[model samples]
Target: MSNKSEALSRRFEAAFMPNYGVPPVALARGEGSRVWDVDGAEYLDLIGGIAVSSLGHAHPALVEAVSRQVATLAHTSNLFLHEPEVLLAERLIGLLGAPARVFLTSSGTEANEAALKLAIKYGKANGRPYVVAAENGFHGRSLGALSLTGKASIRDQFGPFPADVRFVPYGDADALKNAVTAECAAVFLEPTQGEAGVVPPPDGYLRAVREICDTTGALLVTDEIQSAIGRTGHWFAHQHDGVLPDVLTLAKGLGGGLPIGACVGFGDAGTLFAKGDHGSTFGGNPVSAAAALAVLDTIESQGLLEHVKTVGTLLAEGIASVEHPLLKGVRGRGLWLAVVLTAERAARFQTAAQHAGFLVNAVQPDAVRLAPPLVITAEQVTSFVTALPALLDEASHD
Candidate 1:
């Protein structure tokens, strides 16, 4: 590492909490699906900052938007209205092609937090106070969001959490139906369990969940923080099953690398949170909202949705053609793909691939999740595929 890099890393460790441990590299800069370490070594940013950089590093549109907005008006409290906030909300609702209202925040956790509060209010209004979530599903780290998350390792440390939260087996309609009672207020789920190694639900699962929610009068809440915004080919992953969620939580790529989150509600559920029920100081700040608008505009103008679907298919097929036993198969849609291995060697493979000039994420011990920017090229996918066997070989030895 350079002197500058070492000094910065040391300062970072000293100043920041130790929850995530040490970061592997001190990044200097990024551009168009690639990032450079402080030492000037470049690597393909395959994970896209955990699926946040939808337009990749430093897209011109995003750069221009943030720059212009910061100069014009960066922030204004919720006491006043802002043009970017209003426009972005309209864009989100229009994108969903459904009647919805939006509540914006600064991060995915906050988005889920708002959704949780909305669920509670909606339930109380309708005489149901219980909430049902799926096993292995991840929401966020805040108290309410953490309570709904089904991962024992994450939730175990924080409890005893709020009561009346239940976990049902994901993709299991029977289990979901059995768990959701008429007293349930909502059913929270991830269309594809991204953190659980990109586990896509079984066919008809989402539609089935929708049916269960309807039958039980429970609001269907889909946390799409990791899967929405063209990451999954469709605008939202739930659309693959022709199902519509009552409440949808989005973040990650919504701001194209800038931090932003949105909780959108449909129908009467949209009005559950009255004026003072929830609010955020920095939610929908003009700068972040402008950044989101630029991302949406570029996604449409550049036809990134079709690009995601096309290049994503190529990447999946190319990886599968590698023909390695430890390599199981690819799951997920659009630019969001996960390479599954037979054993828990994901961290090993991740290190090996990093050395080979690619950045990836070990979402689990047995899987590496790939969420490259929607703008990533076919050539880059081909290069990564070509380098996979060597990465696997090194991982196998480790």
Candidate 2:
């Protein structure tokens, strides 16, 4: 690490909480799919801020929209209405291809919190007190969302979560069917388990879950925080199975890099919350809304959905073709991928990749996640693939 970066890390440790520990590199600036460290060392940004930087860094459209909006009307609290917020909501609903109501939040945790409240309200109204979620699935870290998160490692530390929440094994249709009884208010699922090393469910898992929800009159809620907004070559990952959820929560890439989240409720689920039920102060701040609008507009204008599919396939195929003993396979779809290692060397692999001027996440001990910007090109992917063998060799030695 550079001296400047080391100084910054020391300052960060002293000044801030250690919730995220210390980031390995202190980035100075970013452009497109690359970022520079404080020492002016450039690295290919494959993680893309944990799948939050949809358009990569310093995108022109995002910059102009945010700048213009902040200069004109930066923030108008929920006390009043704004054009950007309304337009963003409309655009989201239109893209969803269904009749839905949108509740905007500042982050994915807030969005899931809102969804939790909606589920609670639905439970109260319908006398269904149970909520089913998949084991090892991640929603968020806030208390409400945390309650819905089925990961024992995180949830065990936070005790006495909301009651009547059942967790079934992920990608198991039979388990979900058995757990989601008629008394279940909602079933929260991630179309692709992002935090679980981008583990995608079985081919007909989502469709079967939808059917089970229909049979039991339970509201299906899909959390697409890390899998939506063209990240998975679709507007929403649930759409891949041609299934629609009654409620969908999104964030991560919604505002490209700005903080924004949405809790969209469909059909009768849309009207569950009446006046004065739930609210947010900076939910739809004009600047963030404008940025999100720009992201949506650019995705459509540039045909980035198709671009993501083509480039993602190339990257995945290239990684799979690498003749490495440590490499097991690749998982997930589109730009959201996880390189499965044969052993618990993902941490070493991440360090090796960083030393080689590439950034990837050790999402699990045996999985290295790559969620590059949706705008990443084939050439950039090719570069990474070409360098993978040596990076793996270094990891093996370490």
Candidate 3:
């Protein structure tokens, strides 16, 4: 580490909580898909702030939008309406191809929390008491969203959560059918489980779940925080299965790099939350909303959805073709991928990749996640694939 990086690390440790552990490198700045550390060493940023940097770093459109919005008007509390927030909500609802009402928030957790409150209200009105979620599916970390998350490692420690939340195995329609009853108020699921190593459900799994929810009178809430915004070569991952959710939660890539989230409710689900049912102090601030609108507009004008499909295939196929003993295969779709290792050496693999001037995430014990910027070029994908064999070899030796 450089002297400056070490100094910053020490300062971070002194000032912040230790929940994230100590980062390996202190990043100074980024452009496109590359970031430079404080020591001036450049690394390809494949994680993209865990799928939050949709347009890469410092893109012209995002920069101009945020700069202009901040200079004009930044925050207008929900007490009064703002043009940017209204435009953003309209754009999101139009993308979903549904008649929906939006409740904007500051993060994915808040979005899910809003969805949970909507579900609880629906349950109270309908005399249902239970909410079903998928095992190993991640929603968010707030107390309410955490109650719906089924990951044991994170959820176990922060217990005494809200009651009547049941978990069924992901990708198993029969299991969900047996678990969701008439008394279930909602079923919260991830179209693709991002934190669970970018695990995609089986074919037609979402359709089956939709049918089950329809039969049981349970609202289907698809948490698309990690899978939306052209991450999976689609506007929303559930759309790939031709399924429409009653309540949809989104964030992560919504504001390009800014903090924002939305909980969109369709049909009757949209009307459950009346005036003053819920609100956020800084949910749809003008700055974040402007950034989000720029992201959506750029994605459409630049044809990034098709670009994601083409480049994602190249990256996935390139990693799969590498004849490395430590590589098991690749999983997930589009740019949201997980390099499955043959063994539990993902941490070592991440360290090795960092040393080799690339940034990836050890999302699990045996999976390294890659959710790069939507603007990442085919050339960048090739470069990463070319370096994979050696990185895997180093991790094996380590």
Candidate 4:
């Protein structure tokens, strides 16, 4: 770390909790898909803040919407109605092509927590007592959300959660079918498991899960927190399989960078929650709502969804063209791809990529995840791909 970076780290340690440890670089500014550290070192942000920066940094639409909304109206505390909040909810439901009720929150885990509560209530009323989730699936760290998560390492440390939850291996249709029984109230899954190295289930897996949920009279809850909002070339990743979930949890890219989350319930699930059943203080704050609106509008107007598909394909091809022994190929949809590596060199590769002026995430021991801004250009994708050979070489030696 540079002197300036070290000084910032010191200040951060002095004033902040040590939960995240200290970051290697202290970012000073960002524009489009690039960010600069305090020491003036620039980098291409390929991870997009873990798939949250949908429109990239300092986007005009987001800036204008937030600035305009904050200047006009910012908060209502869910006690009063706001136009931006209502409009955002309507827009999201319209995108889903369904009639649903939304419970907006401050983050994705909170959304999942709300969804779990809804499920438990609905199930308790229906005489069901168990919830099923996929192994390696990440919901969040809050107690309830953490319980629903299937990762043993993260969840086991924080338990015991208040909910009775079961886990099945991800993408295993037969295991899921056997696990989700009549006693199961809900089955939670990700249309595409993002944190598990951008893992996508087999084709027809979601449909099978839906069928199982239907047979067992259980609600199908899909966590679209990381895969939704055009991250996977679709508004909702489950839509690619032509299925609608009973409950959908959304966050990450929902506010295009602002902190926001939503638990959207469809059909009977939508009407399950009555007044005072659930609420949030900053849920759907006008400014975040406006920012979300800007993000959706920008995705539609600029045709970034299609752009993501095209550029994402280009990137996959570019990266695959390299014949390095370290390369294991890429897997994912749209901009959410995992560059597979042959060895347990992912953390080293991340460091090398950082040194090479590109940002990526080591989501697993052998997977480097790439979820760049939706506005990232073809040239930027190509640039990252071209830099990978040398980065891999450095990682190999390191």
Candidate 5:
């Protein structure tokens, strides 16, 4: 490590919370799909801030839009209106292919929180208060959202959480059918289980869930925080499944690295909140909205949706074709993928990759996750494929 980086690391541990541990490298700068540490070492940023930096680092379009908006109108505090927020709402609703109402927040957790409340309110009015969520599903970490998450390891210590929430196995249509009844308020699902290591549901699984929700008169809420915004070669993963949800929540990549989230309610779910039911102080701030608009506009104009499809296939295929013994297989869509290892050595793989001047995340013991920026190229994907065998070797020997 560089002298500057070591000093910064000492200071960071002293000054900041230890929730995420003391990161070994302090990033100094970033551009495109790469970032440099304070020690002047370049590392390919594969995780993209846990899938937040969709446009990659220092994209000219994102910088310009944020700079211009901050200079113009940064905040209206939700007490008033902002043009960028309105435009973004229209764009999202149009992309969603439905008439919906929008509630903007600061992150995916807040989006899920808002959607949960909306479901509860709507359910209460119709004689239902129970919400069904899928097992191993991750919505957020906030109290209300945590209650809806089916991961017991994270949610156990935080309880007593909100009541009347049930969990069914993800991708199991029969389990979901059994759980979401007329007494259920809504069913929350992640189109793809991201933190569970990019686990995708079985074919027609979403269609079955949709039909179950429709039949049981329960709302369907899909959380697309890490899988949306052109990440899965689609605006929303549920769109690829051809399913319409009553509530859809998004964040992560929405603002291209800025803090922004949205809870969009379709049809009756949209208007569930009254004038005073819910709100956020800095939710729809103009600067973040403008950044999001720039992200959307760039994705559309650059034909990145098609690029994601083509390059993502190459990435998945390349990883699967590798002859490393530690390699098991690959899963996920577009730029988001999980490298399934034969052994539970993800932490060692992560450390090896870091030392090799690459950044990836070990979301599970047997799975190393990769959600690189949408701007990543075929060359970058191939480069990672070529380098991964050495990293796996480093892990295997360790």
Candidate 6:
């Protein structure tokens, strides 16, 4: 059998309940911004594994930290305190520039789940129980998190959701001001809405929401899952406007490709979870925490935040110059970019981009999101931009 087919056969047999479709390419290894398939065909990875590979493949710092910690001590559950977990917490709070409490988990969904529960508990404490979120804002897929997600397709099959959640237009501060009453305990936002096609809010929109929440005494929860941890040229995406969320949900890039997530709570929200209020068995494990610390240290030491902004600007300008009828414009900040195409051409463009030895994603029918690793260079972005006109032409015919 061919090596690729043989590998796929084995994976299909061993795996359980496929959620992501059948495999496309079997990745062998990766370094920097490149990945090679099992057949040894290499491609420039612009999607960055759906924006998870912040430092790209096998970054030396991540390798060293994870290796040392795993060899020394791997999994020590929440039964006791561990150095890696404590150290990571301190670093995260310091970067946020606020007194924050952290609840670590294994993935972004878990972090969102924990955050949703905290909002619920906080609501009960304040004698208010409703939560407010925005249309087209995606939080996560878990039952609790899905309840807050504004996408209808994602939440359609799973009905009978918790009763107290409401949705309004994203970036509509006035709508939020009208929707959130005294009965609402919290409002969740993604500074740049990643999954619903890299939609950045209107200028000063986040600041306005913060003001509205303050006036209403409601917590402002920011889901930084797709835009946080240097993906958007900042420690946190919302920090661009100098706004602090009552609670922040983070993952994707936090562990440098390893599975780790955290819900950071600031001020009074920080102390909401008392002893026995919430816990995760495998949360804050030493190995994952070690990986996160390395990601943070590397970002600071390498000045990757600056690099992201520089390269991302080039990408946006390059995409804008593509000169295709389907190409509308580019949105988002830093490495988190989305190209708006005409009609439902995102899928076609994704296929075309892949065939051209590059990778990106169709976040929606008309928008394609490109969130490459922060490590991607200007030269690589130029190469992708150079190929865009032809790629769009081909995708249009397809």
Note each model's CA RMSD in angstroms. Answer: 1.0, 0.7, 0.7, 0.9, 0.9, 1.5
Off by over 4 Å in 4: none
List candidate 6 segments past 4 Å from native.
1-14
Residue 44's lDDT within candidate 1 is: 97
TM-score of each: 0.98, 0.99, 0.99, 0.99, 0.98, 0.97
In terms of lDDT, the poorest run of 10 residues in model 2 is: 156-165
What TM value does model 3 have?
0.99
Evaluate all candidate structures by whole-model CA lDDT and list the values in order.
Answer: 0.92, 0.94, 0.95, 0.92, 0.92, 0.90
- Candidate 6 lDDT over 214-293, as tens digits, reads 98888999999999999989888998988999999998899888899999999988888889988898888899899999
Error of 5 at 70 (Å): 0.7
Tell how far residue 318 is off in model 6, in angstroms.
0.9
Q: lDDT, candidate 2, residue 112?
A: 95
Whole-model lDDT, model 5: 0.92
Instruction: Give lDDT tens digits, candidate 3, residues 1-398.
Output: 87899999999999999998889989999999999999999999999999999999999999999999999998889888989999999999999999999999999999999999999999999989989999998988888999999999999999989857999999999999999899999999999998889999999899999999999999999999999999999989998999999999999999999999999999999999888899999999999999999999999999999999999999999999999889999998999999999999999999999999999999999999999999999999999999999999999994
Tens digit of per-residue lDDT, candidate 4, span 204-265:
99999999999999999999999999998988899899999999999989898999999999
Candidate 5 vs 6: which has more TM-score:
5
lDDT of 6: 0.90
| Model 4 local distance difference test score | 0.92
Best of the candidates, lDDT: 3
lDDT of 2 by residue, 123-154 (tens): 98899998999898999988899998988988
Clashes (N, CA, C under 3 Å) per candidate: 0, 0, 0, 0, 0, 0
